[model samples]
Target chain A: MLTIATGNKAVAAAVKEVRPEVIAAYPITPQTEIVEQIAEYVTSGELDSRYIPVESEHSAMAACIGASITGARTFTATSSHGLAYMHEMVNWAAGARLPIVMANVNRALGPGWNVWAEHTDSFQERDTGWLQVYVSTVQEAYDTALMAFRIAEHKDVLLPVMVNLDGFVLSHSMQSLETVTPGDFVPPLHLPHAIDVTNPAGYGTLTGPDEHFKFRWEIEQAMRKSVRVIADTERDFAERFGRQYGVAEEYRYEDADVVVIAMGTLGKEAEVAVDLLRNEGVKAGSLRVRWLRPFPELDLSGRDIVVIDRDYSFGFGGVLAHSLMAKSRIEPYSVIAGLGGQEVTFDDIAGFVRDRTPGSETWFGVKGNV
Target chain B: MTEIPKEEYILKCTSACAGCPSSLILRYVLKAAGPDTVLVVPACCTSVIQGIYPNTALNVPVYNVAFAAAAACASGMSEAFRKAGKKTSVIVYAGDGGTVDIGIQALSGAFERETDFLYICYDNEAYGNTGMQRSGSTPVGARTTTTPGGKTHAKKDIDAIVAAHNPSYLATACAAYPQDLFKKVGKALSLRGSKFIHVLAPCPPGWRFSSEMTVEMGKLAVKSGIWILYERESGKVTINGPSKAAMIKPVPLEDYLSGQGRFKGISQKAIDALKSQAEQRAKHLQKEAEGIC
Candidate 1:
């Protein structure tokens, strides 16, 4: 069915298509619409799923963990503070290897108390054994959410997957999305370690030092193997739905001299900036790294790269930029922009690309830093 | 009266401390819940006593969760079972520290939402799993590792807090009284809405008593009018036999406090305070039972 909906609604629509057996969630701004839509579906008898209107985000994730362990496909949604509050269970969900899917509307954390688009929230959870994919448009959000279940529940990749969309930017903004009745696309989940009522068992028991590392290694092994699972899932999704996605969405980079890289909505804007730079006769391309975890290699080789980060790591610089430097051993012009839903237009992004200085960092809005 | 089931969900040879009644409470709880049950345990002694992986001491499924999350986890597990058209009992077996302290919010949330599950908090009055640290459930004038000089505050009234939710079934049980504990679990499972059974489990090592005095300690608590055992089912409160008898002619409070090492250096003032509080609590329960509140 083709219709127009906000990014949040698109996620809920995809979830309805996947038809999770259980959904436990608490409302948070920019992400509240997702859960509200899901609740409406559950209430209207359009969806046959257990919807738990939990009091807090911690319970939301914990409930999902409990349901997921029962061999039931489960989902939940939250943003910023809610994500931060549920940080502990977020790690446990992965450690327990429960393939629970979650939609996180990217929003900045508070001290200054801003509830707006930023990547810092999910970035803080980068080390947690969760596969993360940031979507740029409502269509992509719906598509990735559908594929998330298939990828996370794959036998080779029994790990939770986080679908990220910018708070307010993509989450509340309406866009055209084509929803599909994902029958047979996402198969019935079979959690090998799911609790059985007939047979008494113990899960999440204490593991001495001797065997603890082995479980961690198993998670890593599954994560490393998920690269293949992700590729295959996305390929299958493209074949069935006629919508193609990749680890990184690259545009006009075949013979460009300079390429701009970003994520979420900024990644989409970066494409416009690339076109702007191209009109000015600048040989620039755009590369939006979609999947943050199981991070895609940009293949920048011999070209000057400009990386924009909507999140920063205070002392370590941009997470994406620094991680790329460590992995690819390349110096990219690192620019921190669009934090706290701060306005950064295509002109500003194009300007960042035009004045690309390798090995240097710039804070876009800072008076002295830029 | 239903005879106690002979089959045990908790097998012998676990790592529970000697004279620990928390495990005993679980033994009865599982027997009542039976094989069609899933025990959601947070970071408590039960988590350890359930044995390490590949060698669980339990015959029923146990989902050991993080501290302060047992109730919330059970809410999900129960919903999943019910939605699947299965009547698998979801029981949260947590300790005092995980209940009255760290896990209180989740507990309140689950009960208020009317999650169909039985929550049991085996109160040992201290953080026994963490080497006897002081907990909110620890009584006044009792010492824990964290309260070296004896605690200054009275025990938090978790029963009162839980009553505010007005669950379908609510009861207080002692490990010394397994029959009562067993019956409460059976009743709670028979109903549909949220149910809670708070068991005052005596810990010999944590409380500084001889291993053999675990049941005796629990008896003294109820006999002395300190820890009242009762059931509040659908708004009617019935003080149990031991507490009802104590109300008419209670034993001395010192009989309950004397053997516990946690109260070795109790001041005269603290002792009087403890006695007064216990008397006031008993009066309130007695009046409420007689429809006098």
Candidate 2:
């Protein structure tokens, strides 16, 4: 069925279809509507799930961990500060290897207190052992959320997953989404270490030096195994719903001489830039990385890549540019743009591709030259 | 004495110190909670006492969580159990540092939501696991490693703070009195909504006392009015233990403070102040009890 919904509502709709046993979340801007809609679904009897209005984001994640380790499908949503607060438990969920799914609205962290779209929030948690997938549209938000459970809970890949969407850009913007029926795409949750009274099991135990390294290695092994699980889950979803998603989606890349690489809604904007560049007869295309972790293998060997990053690593460089460089030895012309929800239209992106030099970074629209 | 139950859910081997009162309190509570209980323990002494991974002292399932997250974790566990169609008792066992200081927000949230679980705070006075540091539950004039001279302020009224949330069952228990603590745990298990029990677990090393004097220190605490025993059920408060023996004058504060090296050479002025504070609190409890049914 076709319906008009914001990215937040799309996530809620997908979660409803998955039918998680427990939903725990605290309201944070851009992420608030997702929980509000879930609450509505619970109250309206559309979804039979326990909704815990947790006091803080830390508790929200803690509660999710509580439910998740009990063989229950659990979910929660949060924005920048909420995500920061949930930092400790966010790491806990992944380290414990619970297949919990969370829809994180990508917002910039505060000191200046801006609640705008930025990748820095989720990017900071890059090493927390969570499989992070950034979505570009309302439809992808709905689709990726549904597939997250299957990917995370796959026997070989029992790790937490975070589906990140651009805070205000995708979270609040209305777009048409094709809703799928509740299918067997995601199987019933079965946590091998679930708390059972008949056969009790202890979780998140204290590990000493002798055994701690082995536990850490196991998480890494599961994370590596998720690449295959993610591919398989997406394939199954595509077969069932006739819509496909990949770890990285390439658009007009085959014949293009230059390609723009990005994640989230910036990728969608870059696609538009590709079209404009093509009309000008410039061989330009876009490679949108959907999954940040299980760091997808990309063939950026032949093409000159222009990496547009909505987030920066302070003293270092753009996250996407750094990843691409680390993977394929591609010297990406990293352009820092749209930070804290600063406007980066197709024209600005096209101009970046047209005027950029190879190697190093360029701070788009900033007065200072990099 | 109702013949304290012999059922034990804790294992014989524990990583706790020789005189750790928390282990005894946990053993007794677990005995009452039975086999169908899941403990959500935060960063406290119990976190270590439960032992390292692959070797837990607990026979029942335990979810060792981060500090300041026991109540929230238990809240989730309770809801999960309810969803799973299991009637298991979800319990949270935290220390003074985790409970009164760091974990209070989560505790208050759980209470407000009326989450069905038994929240226990094993008050060992200071952060005993971290080696005698000052915490919100550290009493007045008691010297911890952090408070070299002596703690300047009185202990935070955690029981009264929890009571403000109006839990289904609320009680203050002492490890020195095992039967009373066990009975309270059993009673709390019988109730439905949010329940909280504050257990004064005296730490020998932290209190600067000999390992053998753990029980004696706990008894003296109650006798000196430093640790009062009481229960709050549906807004009613009932004083228990030595505090209830109002007719016989309470034991002097020095009786509790004198022997412990932590309180060694404590001035008479500080003792008087602590005594006055305890008296005022006891009097307030009495007035509050009179107003209740």
Candidate 3:
């Protein structure tokens, strides 16, 4: 049934439906509401699970990892500094192939210390071997949380997954969401039977110099397999929930000259800008990246694209822009703007697309230098 | 009292340093912890000491994680086992550098979560694997590669830091006192929540001591009050051994310093300062113990 709810609540309800055995959480802004609601469910006996109230984001993830390796469906949530705090565990979870799911409310990391929407938190952990998916709407956030578990636990892709939603913009903002129950959630595809202690297999065992390289190589191979598993899971999700979203979602790209690729809640605004540009007779479209990691290179072929990056990479202009250019052929005007929680107004995006000329790469919506 | 089975648990055929205090401590810990334990190790000297694949000295399953990820990795493994309905103890063994320096953030996180596991940090003071570099736990007036004559900073108060986290149990031990170290490990294993035990394992190579002098140096360190043994529970401190004043005769700081090359260049003034600091610290610990009593 479709219900009006905030992104945080939608994620909480989705996780509750998944019926994870353990929910380890530390209260941080934006991400707190998800855990708070889950805690209430657990306390009220609505969600039958152990809810560990951790002292910090790092510990929250640590507890989740412990629970996960024990063959339990484990989860945790965090944002910005909390994500940074759990940075080390992010790699551990992936390397261990624990299949733990996390919901990250995207927030700006600070010198100014603002708790607002940005992509830095999730983007910074790009290399942590997690299958990262950014959601633009409350419904997508709700759906992605469910699909994440399926994709992560797949035998061919035993890796952790992060479902990131923009803080305040999506996490706090209320929208309509369709909920799925646990009964309807499992039993679709084959998955490894819950870690069997009876068989007594060891996990994350010590790898000395002899086996260390092979162990890391196996993790990398699993990540590569995740690209295919992501597609398969999305297909299964569409069949189950009547919604289709996978690595990338294209809107009116056929016969279009310029495409603006983005992820998270910013994609929603970019869609609006693309529609306005189309109405104005500009050859522009939007590519909403559902899967941020594994880079989705298959979608970037033969296109002149403008990436609207919401986070800066310090020495590099935009992390996503740099990543995209590194893999695919770059068209003119791959601009970076809307950083540090700066508003990416429709006019800001429309102006950039309108001013774009063939072979002119530009960073739009940014003040001063390109 | 049941005597510890001192049937030489460590294999003489193994490939650890000739007089590695950590190697001896590990053997004792494993024996006390028994065969049912799972160990999580990070990138440290112990990882190398455990030897290459198919040549490990340990009988328990050991997980070698990233340098800064032992706590998190162990937590995940523990959780997985619990979810699968397994009843097994999870233990993480880290060195001073891994536990007190780069891995501290992860360690702090694990403690905060109250994961049901035992975390043991073998404090040898410096980064032994990387050739005796100074770590956060390196003591003041100790010469390491980074701290040539003496470390400018004092060793971090890790016990206090851990106690502040309100863990279920926290204790300090030294390889010199096998009974105390074994008892603490056994106690930590019985606790359900996060438990921390810091063992002062003297490094013969890093401390610039002769192979045979490792245990002697550890004994002198405690006798001089430079390495105190205490436990904290419910925010209360309890000293395990005799109080500084109650001791028959406190060993001179020079006796402890003389065995280690790291402290060979210490001036008389510096030694006197160290002695006073050790005495003051022991007194404070005694007071805390008294308050608990």
Candidate 4:
């Protein structure tokens, strides 16, 4: 059924379909609406789940961890400092292979304390073994929420997954979405119960110094398998709901010399900018990265790419650009712009692409700001 | 129903130090926690006694996390079980040095999140794991590796800090009282959300006491009001044990202090000051329990 919904509401409605047994969350700006909607669903009897009202972001993850261990599909949502507060647990969740799903409304980490869109929040947790997927639009938010369960619960890849949506840009932005019923959505993806007290299994048990390396290696292997599972799940979603997203979502990239790669809301803006550039006879295209952690290496090879990094990595210029440079040797220039709620205009993006030089780190819309 | 023999119920293990209060308290904790619990142990003496490769005294699953990551690891384990649909209890078994110092941030994070788990800090005053080093929980005027003559800082008020988080259950116990320790462990296991128990475990090596004097030292510490038995439920303090008889004068601080070589360098004035401080803290706790403070 097609319904008009905000990204947060769409995520909440889609998660309701999963019928998560427990929902524990403490509200932070932008992400608050997701939990608030879920609370309403619980109160209205639309969803039957245990909602744990936590005091802070740390406890929210803690409560989810507790409820999840006791045979429940737990869910939580947070943004910015809340995500930072959950920094330790992120490593824990991934190492334990919890298959827990979270919605991170990507916002900038504070000191100056701004509440707005940025990728730093989720990007910072990239190596924490979470299958991080960035949603470019409201429909993708709903679609990714459904797909997250399948990818996370995959037997070969039993790790937590985070659906990253731009704080106010996508979280508060409304659009049409096609929602599925819980009964129809869950059965095919649901695997046999992994946790049973009767037939006990040891999880997150102590590893001696000798066996610790092997345990982490096993986690890495499982995460590697997620790339295939992510692709498969995206195919399954497309078959079921006629919408697709995962890894890299390419737009007009065929026969293009200059490709702009980005994630989240800026990718949406980049799509518009790409078309504008093309009309002006500038052979430009865009690739929106839906999955950031399993850094879509296959898509980045042999391409003159321009990465729009929304957040800085402090001493280092751009986190995404640095990651790309570290991974496969790609001749890509990073445009460090749109930090702490700063606007990324089309002119700024166009100016960067127009002056694009291969193998150099340049800041777009950063000149004269400092 | 027929009754089993009392002799059969008692453990026949002979490995622990003579009259070790922690050895007895640990037995009760394991009994109450059962085989389904996963324990996270940090760098501490208990971690040493639990032993190096292939000689674990514990029957259930145990993880020897880093000094500062026990709470974080336990939180992770709890989440893992939740995802798998298992009901296993996640317990963090840390020492005073680990809990009161290195692991404080992780502990605070876990408590703030109200993670459903039991965090037990076996407080043996100083760090017994590293040749009796002074920890945050070490009492003022007590001698140790850092405090050669006497400690300058007071024992960190951990119970108050934990209670401030509004945990579901918080209590203090001693290995001398096996039944009390057992009941508190059982109670903590039954409750949901974050629960903390601070057990005063006397170290024969660190306390400069005889191996056989462990339980007696514990009892003396409590009876003299050096360590108070208190519990907090939903952020309200409640004193559990009865106050010592007023007719019987409180023992001199030296009586308790003399047992430990840690306090051997304390001057008469310092001992008197410690005695008064212990009494005042106990009275304050008692008043809080009585709903007057």
Candidate 5:
């Protein structure tokens, strides 16, 4: 069925199709609506699941972890401080190899308490061993969520997945998406390590240094192998749903002298800027990074790259820019923009790409303000 | 009822100290919960007592979670079992540090939401796992590693705090009273919604007492009205066990305080104050129980 829905509703709609056995969540701005919609679905008998209204985000993730260890499909959502609060359990879920799916609304961390779109929140969790997928549209928000289950639960990749969408930009904006019924696309969940009462065994116990290092190495190996698993899952998803996606979504990058690299909604906006530059006799394109973890190594060779980061890592440069420079060995212009949900239009993005110097980091839009 | 079954779910050897009461508590708790139970333990003595990986003393499934997540984790396990249509009892076996202090928020949340599970706070009065340090459950004038001079405030009334939530079953027990502790555990297991069993588990080393005196200290604690025995079930409360007599004719608090080296400080004023406080608290609990009934 096709219908217009907000990004949060789209996530809820996808969760309905996924049919998780348990859903645990706490209300956080820009992420509350996702849980609220799921509650409505559960109440109306649209989804058969136990919705645990946990006290805090930490408990929410902890609850999901407990449920997931039992081989039950679990789901949760949080943003900014909520995600930060769940940091301990976040590592736990990944370490225990539970394929729990969470929707992390990208909001800026606060001293000023702003509930708006920024990548710093999810970006901070880049090394927590979770498979991170950044979505740009409401449809992709729904689609990525559905695909996350298959990717995370794959035998080769039994790791938790976090689907990132911008706080207000994608969470509150309305867009049309095609939905599916349960069991149509996503398969029934099957976890090999599920807790069985009749045949119970201990889980997540203390391990000595002799074996702890081996277990950590195993997680690293699984993360490395997840790349192929994710690709295969997305391919199968496209075959079933007729909608295609990749680790990195390319926009007119072929035969271009310049490419603007970005994530989330800004990645979508950069496509407009790319087209604008192309029409004005500038050979420009955009490369929208879809997933940051298993972080796909794209062939950014022979092009002047311009990286637009919505987050900055203190002492280091922008997260995306650093990752790009490390992987591609390219000194791209790293421009920080749209922080704390600050407005950065296509014109601003085009201006960033137009007057870019290689290897230089620019605090775009903050030049005059600061 | 039927002798409460003599089967021991936990094995003989544990990582617990020589006279740690946790082994006894675990044995009784598991006996009541049965083989089809899942235990969620945080960073407490039970976490270490369960033994190292691939070699646990427990017969049932154990999920050793983070310090502040035992209740929430058990909540998830119960819900998972319910959804999977499996007959499983999820229990949180946490220490006083995880229960009364760091883990209170999670416990309160679980109780408020009425998540179906059993939470047992084995109050050893201090953070025994991380070395003997003062915790919320540590009584006033008792010297701990952190509270070298002695804790300034009285023990936090966790029983009263949890009772405010009005759980399906709530009780306070001690290992010294095996039959009563087992009975409360059995009763809690029979209920459906959130249930709590707070056991005053004494730590010989942490309490600065001889290893052989753990059970005796537990007994003295109740006899002196320091640890009151009570149960709040289905909106009605009742005073239970040895403490019931102490409510009418209070025992000398000196008997309880003098036995432990933690209270070795020579302060007659503090001793009198503690005794008076225990007497007043017991009287208030008895009055509250009468009103509830």
Candidate 6:
């Protein structure tokens, strides 16, 4: 069905189509709409799912782990502080190799207390054995959430997946969404180690030093192999749903002199900036990184790169810029913009490309270049 | 005293300490819950006692979880089982620390939701898995490793806390009385909607007593009315065999406290306080049972 919906509602719609058997929900700002929508669906009999309104985010993830381990498809949604609170169980869901899907509304971590768009929250969980995908549009959020189940439940890639959307920007912004009846797109999860009620088995037992690292290595091995699974799932999804997605969404990069790289909503805005620079006769293009973990292979050998980061790593340079520099062996000018919902227009983005110093990082709107 | 099934769920060998009452409590717990059950355990002695990875010393399936997550996990598992159209019993077997300390919020959450599961807390009075550290459940005047000078705080009333949830069924048991423990488990499982069983698990080594005296120590606790045995069902309280008898003519409090080295250097003031508290609690229960104020 084709209709207009907010990014959060799109995610809830996709979840209803996928029909996860269990959903652990705890409310947090920007992410509350997703759970509320899901709760409404469950209450109205539109969707048949066991919705657990858990007390805290820790219990939310824990409940998902419990249900998922029993071979039931599961999901949950949360924003910044809730994500931080469930950090332990987040690692657990992946370590246990349960294919639980989650939607994370990207928001800033606080002291000044902001509930706006930032990538720091998701980036903080970079090493937790979870596949992360950032979506720019409502359609993309809906589509990615649907595909998350297929990718995570693939036999060779039994890991949890996090679908991230920019807080208040993509999360609350309304856009077109076309829902699908996922009949066989996401097959039933068959966890090899799932508990059988009839047969008595033991789980979460103490692991001696000899076997603990082996289990960790198995997780890494499965993660390394998920790259292929993700491609196959996305390819199959396009064939069935008529919407194409990739590890990185690219725009006009073939004949460009400089390629601007970014993620989330910043990626979409960077495309407008690229068009503005092109109108001004600057050979510019855009590549929005979609997958953060198992960051895909992009051959950026022959292009001058300008990277926009909505997140930072404190003492280190921009995450995307520094990672791209290491991966492609090229120094890209890094521009930090749109943090804590700081405004940055296409005209300003165009100027960033016009006056690009090869290895310099400019924090846009910071006075005196500090 | 129990015509309970002869089948044993716990295997003969595991890494649990000798005369560990928590394991005894679990053995009865599993037997009553049966094979078609999932035991949600936390970071307790039972977690270590379940044997290492790739090998299980249990007949029924166990889902080991983080310290504070046993009840929360059971909440999810019970709902999942209910949704799947399977009649699988979800039980949480945790230590007192997991129940009264770190796990209280999850327990409250699960019970408040009226989840269909049995929450079993084996109260050994201290964090036995972590070298006998003083936990919230540790009684006042007990000397644990962290309470070398003797604990100054009273034991946490975990039973009262769980009862506040208005559980479908609630009971107190001891490893010294296996029949009572087994019967309580069976009774709790017979009915639904968030049941709780708090068993007084006396640890021999932690209390500085001989392993052989474990059962005797539990018996003494009830004889002196230090640990009451009772059941609360449908908002009514009933004092069980040992506790009912102890209330009429109880043994001296010093008999319960003297044998254990943990209470060796305990002050007279602390003992008087413990005795007075026990007396007040028994009187309240007795009055409630007799329909008095």
Model number with the top DockQ: 1
| B119-212: candidate 6 lDDT, tens digit per residue | 9999999999999999999989999999999999999888888888899999999999988998999999999799999999989988888888
Across A1-370, the per-residue lDDT of candidate 2 in tens digits comes to 9999999999999999999999999999979999999999999999999999999999999999998888899999998999999999999999988999999999998889899999999999999999999999999999999999888888999999999999889999999999998567788988888887777666777788899899889999998888888888888888888888788889998999999998999999999999999999999999899999989888778888899999989888898899889998899899999899999999999999998888978999877777
Q: A1-370 in candidate 1: lDDT tens per residue?
A: 8899999999999999988999999999989899999999999999999999988999999999988899899999999999999999999999999999999999999989999999999999989999999999999999999999999999999999999999998999999988887889999899998989777788889999999999999988998999999889889988999998799998888878998989999999998998999999999998899998988765678999999999999888999999889877889999999999999899999999878889999999887784
Stretches off by above 4 angstroms in model 5 are A182-184, A368-370, B248-251
Would you list the clashing residue pairs of candidate 4?
A59-B113, A65-B79, A68-B82, A68-B83, A69-B81, A69-B82, A71-B85, A206-B63
What's model 1's TM-score?
0.99
Q: DockQ for all models, in order?
A: 0.83, 0.79, 0.32, 0.22, 0.74, 0.77
Chain A vs native chain A, TM-score per candidate: 0.99, 0.98, 0.93, 0.94, 0.98, 0.98
lDDT of 6 by residue, A1-370 (tens): 8899999999999999888899998999989999999999999999999999999999999999889889999999998999998898898888889999999999998978999999988888989999999999999999999999999998998999999999999999998888887789988788888999667687767888999899899988998899999899899989998998799999988899999999999899889999988888988999999999888788998888999999999999789898888887888989998888888787888888888898899999987784
RMSD to truth, every model: 1.1, 1.2, 3.8, 4.6, 1.6, 1.3
- Report iRMS values in order: 0.9, 1.1, 4.2, 5.7, 1.1, 1.0
The candidate 2 chain A region of ten consecutive residues with least summed lDDT is A196-205
lDDT of 4 by residue, A1-370 (tens): 8889999999999888898877878899989999999999999999987676665676567556545544467788999999998787678767766778999998988788889999888888888888888998888899899888877878888788999999888899889887875455444334343334344333444348997788689888988898899888878777877877657788888867788877888887888788889999988888887788777784567667898898877777787777777886787878877777678866667777887777777665455532
Better of 4 and 6 by DockQ: 6
Give the higher-DockQ candidate: 4 or 5. Answer: 5
Model 5 lDDT per residue over A1-370, tens place: 9999989999999888888999999999999899999999999999999999999999999999999988899999999999999999999999999999999999999989999999999988988899999999999999999999888888888999999999999999999888875464566778888877677677887788877888889889999999998888788878878887799998998888999999999999999999999999999999999999988898898999999999999888899998999998898999999999999999999998889888889897665522
Ranking by TM-score: 1, 2, 6, 5, 3, 4
Q: Which residue pairs does candidate 2 place in steric collision? A: none
Query: Per-residue error at A183 for model 3, in Å?
Result: 3.0
Residue B84 in candidate 3, Cα distance off native in Å = 5.5
**Between which residue pairs do clashes occur in model 6?**
A201-B61
lDDT against the true structure, each candidate: 0.92, 0.90, 0.79, 0.77, 0.89, 0.90
Candidate 1: Cα lDDT at B167: 96
Query: Model 5 scores what on Cα lDDT?
Result: 0.89
User: What tens-digit string does per-residue lDDT give for candidate 3 at A204-271?
Assistant: 44456777888688888998988888888778787777898768788787877788788887777888
What is the DockQ score of candidate 3, to 2 decimals?
0.32
Ranking by DockQ: 1, 2, 6, 5, 3, 4
